[model samples]
Target: MAERILIVDDAAFMRMMVKDILTKNGYEIAGEAENGQQAVDMYQEQKPDLVTLDITMPEKDGIQALKEIKGKDPEANIIMCSAMGQQAMVVDAIQAGAKDFIVKPFQADRVIEAIQKALS
Candidate 1:
């Protein structure tokens, strides 16, 4: 079966972009969340094989959600997504146990590469 991935991003367009890439690449999208809180909630419910979590969001940021999810599932495969120049936040995300990260204005190859690396 294709790996199931949960995509979390504040921007609908961002989520759509990721969804498009994943679907075309033969990955299954478990769900989509508009913010970190929803990401956490959906994560618990879906137990997807991987997650692409956006760093900046309303309700809860990706770092906070990443920590929470890691706390619950130490093995949760998570990849942080951030815009360019958010190096500090990305560092925090890596420290918090995110397997990898991808930058926005999504590059299909990089995004796929990160997800593949994390899942592997």
Candidate 2:
């Protein structure tokens, strides 16, 4: 079965971009969330194979969500997404147990590479 990925981003455009890339690459989309709270909630419900979590969002930020999710499922596969100059949060996310991270204005190859690396 194709790996199911939960995509979390505040921008609908960003979510759509990621969904396009993943679907084209043959991955399944388990769900999409626009905020950290929804990301956390959906994670519990979907139990997807992986997650692409955006760093900045309303309600809560990605690092917090990453920590929360990691607290619940240490083995959960999560990849952080961020725009440029959010290096500090990216570091925090990595420390919090995100499997990897992809920068915004995402390159399809890089996105696929990160997901593949995380899933592997």
Candidate 3:
């Protein structure tokens, strides 16, 4: 079965872009959130197989959301997304239990690769 994925980004366009790519590649879009707080809520409701999370967002940011999710479910699969130059945050995300990360202005292959690696 296709993996169910939740996408969390404050920008609707970003979420749409990711949804387009993942759907085209046969992944199921389980849900979407415009902020970290919403992401956490949706996660509990959906329990998706994976989540693509933006590091910068209003109402809590991705790192905080990641922490909340990981705290709730240690095995939660998440891939952090950020623009270039957020290395420190990326490292912090990894330390916080994110399985992998993808840079913004996303490349489809890169996103897929990260998700696959995280799932594996």
Give the TM-score (vs. native) of candidate 3: 0.98
User: What value of lDDT does candidate 2 attain over all alpha carbons?
Assistant: 0.97
How does each model score on lDDT?
0.97, 0.97, 0.97
**Model 2 lDDT per residue over 15-46, tens place:** 99999999999999999999999999999999
Model 1 RMSD vs true structure? 0.4
- Report how far residue 41 has shifted in candidate 1, in Å: 0.6
Badly placed stretches (over 4 Å) of model 3 are none
- Cα RMSDs, all models: 0.4, 0.4, 0.6
For model 1, where is the 10-residue window of minimal lDDT? 111-120
Residue-level lDDT tens digits of model 1 in 79-102: 999999999999999999999999
Tens-place lDDT per residue, model 3, 41-103, is 999999999999999999999999999999999999999999999999999999999999999
